[model samples]
Target: MARAHRREALLAAVLTGALTALALWRVQPGGSGYPVPETPEVCLRQFREAILQGDPERIRNLLSEEMHPHQDRLVREQQPRLTQTLSWVIVQTRQSGQSALVLVHEMHRDGWIYPVEYELLYREPAWQISRISYLPPEKASIAPGTHVREAPWGQELSAPPEPSRTEGPDPEDTP
Candidate 1:
């Protein structure tokens, strides 16, 4: 019975020690608890943080050279939330080998969630941002009483606002 008690105490002590180590790992100044952002998901987390803080330089660093031209575009798009306090959330992250797609949503102060997807590639040193795609608003379906006034791709025509019942009085009715 004494031998069994000693074995149990040893087992408990080992488990407690392991848990303690894990718990304190991240607290260490230079700990390896969380590795450097090597994976796409990890890189994306950093990118999202940069976006939330409006750190254009950080965001640019995360992007690939080919995406440098788009830096201004991204900064411009995020300008709306600069004035208001906003929170960003990563909805989902999908990765395969060196490529990944991270779905993010920025919650506006007015409670609107705008979804954006980040395409990433694991470059030599780390994963880099390839592109950021914003989801477009859903098109309205043509219902019995509904009207399809808006055109695709946000284009506006100068023709007219009113809906016409006949298209030039039909082709056969022309004299």
Candidate 2:
């Protein structure tokens, strides 16, 4: 009877340890101490990294089902080669209920910065990018109170437009 009690106690302890470990694993934040992205902005950052890294499958997974048809073409056009020096920063994000618009500045090796807008939809599990459009410089207006992330590598974030002046005679001509 003593031997039987000892065996049952050992089994119970082992089962308890296994259950505790499993519970901790499930509740752990990303298992690497960094919490998993639960916001649209963080997810968009992940998408940007995936683009820079040229991970086609990750990029496809981050996009919505509606964008699947254009995945091939998008990957061909937007995927930067591993050798290319490129970076991106979020210029603005607007969210209303299930839809969101994220504006980002994509900077290339050359001194060119492009404003790209991504439309995202909050599906059952997470936000998925639905559409992407490149805006002309004149069209990319930043709203007040919008958070603009700084560009990496000393790149200029943006330049405010100069105020328009009424057409008048030049100072030299007037003189």
Candidate 3:
């Protein structure tokens, strides 16, 4: 029947279109575009989105080898806090030859700033977040006892905020 053939063709077209769309959606880079930006502004924007979404996959895509290994740990750290409504406003951004630092004023659902630093490293075509140091950090391995937290990105990402402090002269003060 001609009418039956037409209906079948229409159904097939619809199915094909749906499949194509779904594939595009799934394979799309960062769900924004493939190959996330290495620039400081885009890096911070994507970082905020990844944190808010708590999507580890998105976060991983943005990182290079320097920051990639700790994706799981970063995901675990961010997931619990993702439930809370929050916002990130960039306070400042500093970039050297291959590294960048973004000062983000994270705010609660009520819009009060939660002070923290988000560090980014540019690795050609992408910018990877290297550290997140909460201002006035409590004594911890990941966070310094001072008002500023500074450490190697790889070592700093995994430790808890209140990491145990070994009793001795602080390593940071040596220099």
The TM-score values for the models, in the order shown, are 0.51, 0.57, 0.51
Sliding window of 10 residues with minimal summed lDDT for model 1: 137-146
Candidate 2's C-alpha runs over 4 A off are: 1-37, 81-85, 137-175
Candidate 3: list runs displaced more than 4 Å: 1-35, 109-112, 137-175
> Where is the poorest 10-residue window by lDDT in model 3?
137-146
In candidate 3, what are the lDDT values of residues 16-36, reduced to their tens digit? 999998766532244645445
What TM value does model 1 have? Answer: 0.51
Q: Candidate 2's residue-wise lDDT over 1-175, tens digit each? A: 9999999999999999999987665211213332234568977877767777777666766778899899888777776522232556788999999999999876555545677888998876567889989876432243323365732336665578897877998767885
**Candidate 1 off by > 4 Å:** 1-36, 52-56, 82-85, 137-175
Best candidate, lDDT-wise?
Answer: 2
lDDT at 117 for candidate 1? Answer: 85
Local error of candidate 1 at residue 110 (angstroms):
2.1
For candidate 2, the 10 contiguous residues with the lowest summed lDDT are 26-35
Task: Rank the candidate models, highest lDDT first.
Answer: 2, 1, 3
What is model 1's C-alpha RMSD? 16.0
